[model samples]
Target: MDSYQENYQEEIEYLRKALAFIEEEVEKEAKNLEEKKSDLIAARKDMYENTIHASSDFESLVDINLHSMQINNYISSYNPQRFKNLKKMINSPYFGRFDFIEKGCSEKENIYIGLYNLMDRNTGRVYVYDWRAPISSIFYRYELGEVMYDTPAGISRGDVSLKRQYKIWNSKLKYFFDCSVRITDEILQEVLSQNTSAKMKNIIETIQKEQDIIIRDRDHELLIVQGTAGSGKTSIALHRIAFLLYEGLNSNLRSNEVVILSPNTVFSHYISSVLPELGEENVEQSVFDDLISEVFQGRFGEETRDMQLETLIHSRGKTSGEVRRQSIDFKGSRVFKQILDRLLWYYAHRLIPFEDVYYNGTILATRQQLKNRFLHNEIGIPMAKQLKIIETFLLKKVHPLQKKRLQRLEKIVEKSEGHEFEIKSFSRLLAIRQAVAFRERIRKFTIVDYRDLYMLLFKNHGLLLKLARGLTLPETNKEIILTTLQNLQKGQVHYEDYAPLLYLKLKIEGNDVVSGIKHVVIDEAQDYTPLQYEVFRILYNNATYTVLGDIRQTIEKTADGLLYDDISEILNKGKMIKLSLNKGYRSTCEINTFAQALLGEGTQQGYASIERHGEEPKVIPQETLEAMDRSIVEDIAKFTEQGYESIAVICKTQGEAEKVFGRLKKSVQLTLIKPRGGEVTKGPLVIPTYMAKGLEFDVVIGYDVSKENYVSDFDRQLLYITCTRALHRLVIYYKGDKSPLI
Candidate 1:
């Protein structure tokens, strides 16, 4: 056998022995855990039955506290995650191995790399190192030659003598590769050839060098990853979160400290299992719509992003179309964000005119006194808190007025000619009580609505012009601003206005930065405007950001459709690092080639290199809608017969998706995916292109791919995104002339 094969056999033998040893340790630990679990349950039951009564004895309190501490320690010690880690490593001890010699060292050190580290108990030596270790960088980065890796101490210069990859399954070696340069397609091809499931797979074993750089980036405050479709950007992002958690063990960062903002609810659910599969807990996952809904908290009728896109798409030929588009663009820009900030600063200092509070036709507190208290008092605190101070001051002034009013009521009750003295006295006292309660109720100010606050800023043009001193804002039309304000007042904010409104709210009510999130991962970042980034800055100003998206997949156009460069400008310009992933592994070679054609030339840098090959996509031209529907249903049957379980019939809008589903649901069992459809099932799905932004299917049928439907640049991107969702088969049906972009 060759030297490579021999080494592979030796490694397999070592892993087998390791697995045998791990099995024994697992059994021992399991038995011990069971015993401790019984003791823990008994202790908990005893504590529950014997409640600690309130006592004055300090000694008894100390004894109870110590007893609780001891029980907690025993409970904490019973955690068998170490044994669980060994159990996980038994099937595959390691996926990579590297031989390296430090600059001054004469002997080479052999390092095996895995998801988690494993140690030799007898020798106190590390048998396997975690993939995120500094020394393990050589395995993914360097060839069998001179190499270097960064460490906490400094950069370590080394020479890589060997680089190897292994595929171990169930403690058996399936295959192995000894590479001289980089990891070859022989391994990646096999990995990509597998069938994709409903959930995203953990790609720790198959991360490429380009992806490794993105995953291990530590210095940049804003790390923007602009990758092509199916470039494993999302997977690399999840792995980066795992790496951060692994590296930050000594620091304050934890798994829950990281948050992931996905494009949609379905996309969030699709990638929910990725972190857990990588042996890390799942981070917080949410979409922009959900976050907005959460921030607004039902105060406004929030519109889903898909619904906004629908309005923008169908607004053609309408007179208000151009105005609406201009309004969306204006609201999403940094200039508008600046306007809101200036408005907040202006409002913070100037106290608005307050209404006088009166009781028994007498002024309890004049408006001038309240205004003086609001304007001349503390200026740095939040408006809500300032309002509270004003409320307290007014209440204090009312206390003296309340006393005087009660005395007068008592005098009138005693002197008045009433039938019964007790009844008259009680009636007068109740009137005094009601008047005092009314004064108290008036002093309690209602909260300012976000929508109203946003509109108030937009309506004041003179203040807006003053705020636009250092900034260049486009000439604003009075009509458009009024229309926008009218929409806001009606609780129907445009998609672009949502972020700015939230940002204004954050500014007025001090953004509580004590929310312990340390990192935020925004997927499908092309849809995020600078205003939204500003909102993130206020919400998580201290947190690191990982923004991942493909410009070609951006569905919203009127709102800030940011490319990588635009995003860099919006974030810290020089402090941000931009990375690109050009290799696409989600779809087959044939499918990617067809999709790339839609972008035409000048899109070479974003072109993805497909690893797997499949049948060329079939384009069918039908004369009528009925014919197209029949063809799609028949094709779905054929694909199902061919063992394709996951199939999607993609349309341009929800309306089209509903129409197709109404016809197809009778013939097949399928799910019509909506924006709030939290899960993407394994069977057939009828979905709009925008809703299917971050999901994939084994087979895809373009319900309609006509030029009339996909005429704009954003429409073409939607087409490209939906077409690339197919892994094995892709079929497009158009009623009329095909789109020129396609």
Candidate 2:
């Protein structure tokens, strides 16, 4: 595994030879041009000379207009096919659209010509160059070196270096100078020239460097990267796509296979720009919530993700109503998962559920149809084998449909008697194949253990199995069928567990099941439940998983669910790469400290977390509910007083968040951050904890921690999540029980 630079050398050599050959041809053409071609030749020759006075190439010296003309005119002399190919290269859809796409090598390989004039539209100067040229290395890396180019007067040298890798677009590179190649902006700019953004393309590009290392590691097919806020996790993932493309894996690896399950749809659009910068199209960007919604839609009839997260965030912390909170906790805990495990065993042995029971289109009639199936030595057979036998029985039932199909085939064959005679055996084989396929399809209508499904759905536990089973009943039949169809459409559905998503902590330690994928990367992994982790580990079959998260930021803890858990302990694989990001560039230092203290203690500080100095947190304590409403209204005086545009009224629960949000909306002109809103925003907002999870604010007014809200165990995590949403300042006023997080 050589460095990109080393690989660059090998790839660049062949390119240099090709370039020299083109240059020699250009010189020859310059000689053979008709006498009228003298002006064009002299212009091409002189453009390079003048631009080179400060170290430039012919293309670097021309404007877009001239460069286009130059390329069109010169290419006009080549074969029609070659000329068309050249034009295609210049206008390829994928080129320059994304960093990864532009860098990805198409069938054209590295074939490119030395266009004497490709111009920068902004500067009106020729600056286009093929990426394979020696100077293009600056596009991928920061370099400092000088460059040497052959000239009519002999060798020309220029000092060059790069300030940043990303900002080097549309610049000429000068990497070769004084015999040895080195990394430098001066050398790179002089040797290679391309146009790119300097302002947005900061070496300080908000993405962290270590994340870059993480993304580029080729061996990691499933890198579970858990990055803290502002850790550049998304940014690095985009860069990894580019690295993969530049490394020639683009052909085998598509942008689709590498998927990213973002927190929300808004976040997906927010982070879509980076991939294109590397010339790669965006991967299949989606939110897991939406994906899940698609899976369970119709069956669940639009179960809202916001509502789920809201329920989870509202539940975590409590100081009162201990018993009620504990019940909520247990419902979402490993004990529940254990119960699920028991239920799964029962289902496997004697209670599997079925969505439909249509043997030959008529209703299955009764549970007896499925009960009898289990009585047929199904226990001794493997599950797949049992399915096979069920298929055979269903095929016999569908034999009538096949007879009709066979009649149709016979009619068609009779109409083509001459051809049928010559292809009788072939037609017979085709008929048999089609009959088997149709029989297999008809078997899909039969359900195995429909009784078990009904029990789970109508069960008293009200668990996920019930939720899943309920989808198959008469009322839910169409919905469930539609959802299953949706899952089939995406090609990613895998139905695996019957227990609480958490209960298999130890049972799967060594159980071999589905052949595990080599790597497992869980995004937003910190939000996963303990039982979910247990199941996830088994799903990966002991493959190394990179779990990235900030424990204090758990936004979806059911009213009593635990906010903090040990990933290393739960995962049971101690290959932990702990990353602490304390400095949040999104907020001022004053905000960071308050948020740090807001999470209570010891949970603060990390890899890139910085304290951006700014305003102290503003507290708005209300003497009465009426006074609180008026106070919040009056506080929107100006951005100067409290940076009102950056202010937020944080609520400990979704119900509470909605209450104050509605009140504030009617009382004042305060703006609220919509659920899953845009990141680039400025306004006074009243937001729920889960909705505000990945966002930041300048000033925050903590709403309440009454026993009805934060006093519950689940509200603890919600409280922690809400307080940390502030970027600069935090303000808290409690009218009841003190927040456990505080």
Candidate 3:
């Protein structure tokens, strides 16, 4: 055998020996733990059955407590999972290896990098280094020369003599590489060429230098990452979470202290396997609507962001569409935020606007009296807290009259002649009791909903006009406000209004600041407006943020290019650091080249060239809808027969998705993706374009790309989003003339 092959065989044999030893120890520990559990259970039973004498009671309690703690220690020490992880490492011991000689040290240190650290049990020396460890940076961030890495104490400079990667699987060495300056393309091409599964894979094994920088960053309070369509933005964000968890183990932080706000629930599930594979527990996960429900206490039937996205994708040319877009943009802007702040400040001291409280034809309290009381006391507390104080003051005045008022109403009911009069008297008594109890409810916080506040402003156009002057709002916004009021009257909420409402709610009902959240990582963050960022800042007041998004993929009109700039100012002054991931890591060069054309010339500046190459996307013209459907079915069957597991047929609107699914399901078995769809499963799937954001598939079939379907710039954005989701193949089918953009 060759020299390298002989060396690899020796390493494999050593790993197998280590694996056998670990497995044996794990079994012994498991047996010990079971015996300890049985002993603890018996001791608890004895403690419950024994009746201690008064003289021995103190001694008995102490013994039981001490015994319970000792049992816990035994259980803690008997964890077999660490050995189980070591057993897993036997198959693929390490991916990269390097020799580093420290500045003052003589002997060279050989570091082997893997998913998790493994140690020599007898010698207490690290046998395999975790990819996230400080010493592992030499494998990813340096060439075969001088290198330095930072530690808790300070920087450690060294000379990297050798850098090599191994592709070991199932305890066999498939290949090995000697990297000179950068990683060879052979490994990346092999990894990327594999078929994508339902779960996202951890990128630790082949994370690029750009991605490594983002994952290891912890010094910045706010990190704004603007990447192109396939730049691995979401992947890098998850890695960052994993890094924080590893770093948190030695500090005051915990895994649960970080939160990830994804674009959709399916996207959350898609990325659920990444952190666990990296040896960390899952963090908090939610979408924007869930966050709104959390803050609003799930009152007043709030609309979800998915439904709003569907509306934007389907409604393009109508007047309703225009007004909706206007409302979203206007309400999501900084100018409107200033208007909301003004309204909140003006009403903080006078939140309780009741005119008077009347009991038995006598005025117990007047509006002027309550106003004076509120203005005179607690001048600077939150509106919610201030209202609590007012409630206490008003209750003190109304309690004595409640008994007299109820007695008078009962007498009136007894003296009534007709049944109707008696019923009216009972109603009056109920109203009196409710009036007295209203203050009590206020003490528990039942403030008016944001719908009420928004409707009130619309009812008084003069007040809105006055607020508009402060921001130089265009005159056209007057119509937008009217349309929004109409929607609110029908009990429907616009996406743009959700944030402003939360802001108003916090201003009046006090901020419901959730504690213990040290970091908030947001994916598809360009979709968020300044108003939403304001709400996030208040909710997690002490949190650092990591925002990842692509401006080219901004399908919502509510978001603009200045979103990151506006948010940076709120996170911290000069503390927010901006990073860019320009290279496309998720798609092939051919796919990226076609997707790049969908954006404007200047809009593609942030995008970088990809290394992968594949077949260029094709635009096929057909004569009828039936013909297009037949072609898609045939293609899906062909792709599936060719061993493709995960495929998607993307449609422009929910209506189109449903129609296509109805037809496709009759001919072939496929899953339909809804706005509130569950986890995306394996096999052929039908989905709407908007719901397909932040997700990818092995093969994608664009149902229709006709001019009739894609007419506006927004429609083009949706098309851009759908086309980039394909990893290997893309086919666009149209009924009429081909789209000019294609």
Q: Give the distance in Å from residue 552's predicted Cα in candidate 2 to where it truly belongs.
A: 1.7
**Best first by TM-score, ranked:** 3, 1, 2
Pairs that collide, model 1 = none
Q: lDDT of each prediction vs. the true structure?
A: 0.77, 0.46, 0.77
The clash tally of candidate 1 reads 0
Inter-residue clash pairs, candidate 3: none
lDDT of 1 by residue, 1-742 (tens): 9987788678867777767767777787789999999988887777656647565788767767776886898788897777677788888878888888999999988888987887767777787898888887777777888999989899999898888888989888888778887666777888777666878888867778899898888888889887888898888899999888888965568888899988888888899888876677747887778777877786667677788878877875565665666666677777787777777666655525367777567776777766666666555766666777676555556565545664565565555535345554676556755655664565445244456666776666665667668886545446567777677668676677778878877766778633888889989887777778777777886778899988777665542334566556655534787777888888999998999888778776546675678899998899999898888878888988888878999988889899889988887888898878658888788998888887888899987788787777767778898898988899998988986666
Steric collisions counted per model: 0, 94, 0
Q: What's model 3's lDDT at 633? A: 91
- List TM-score per model, in order: 0.87, 0.52, 0.88
Cα error, residue 59 of model 3, in Å, equals 8.4
lDDT of 2: 0.46
Off by over 4 Å in 1: 1-5, 48-56, 78-80, 346-351, 354-379, 394-449, 457-479, 488-492, 512-514, 558-575, 606-608
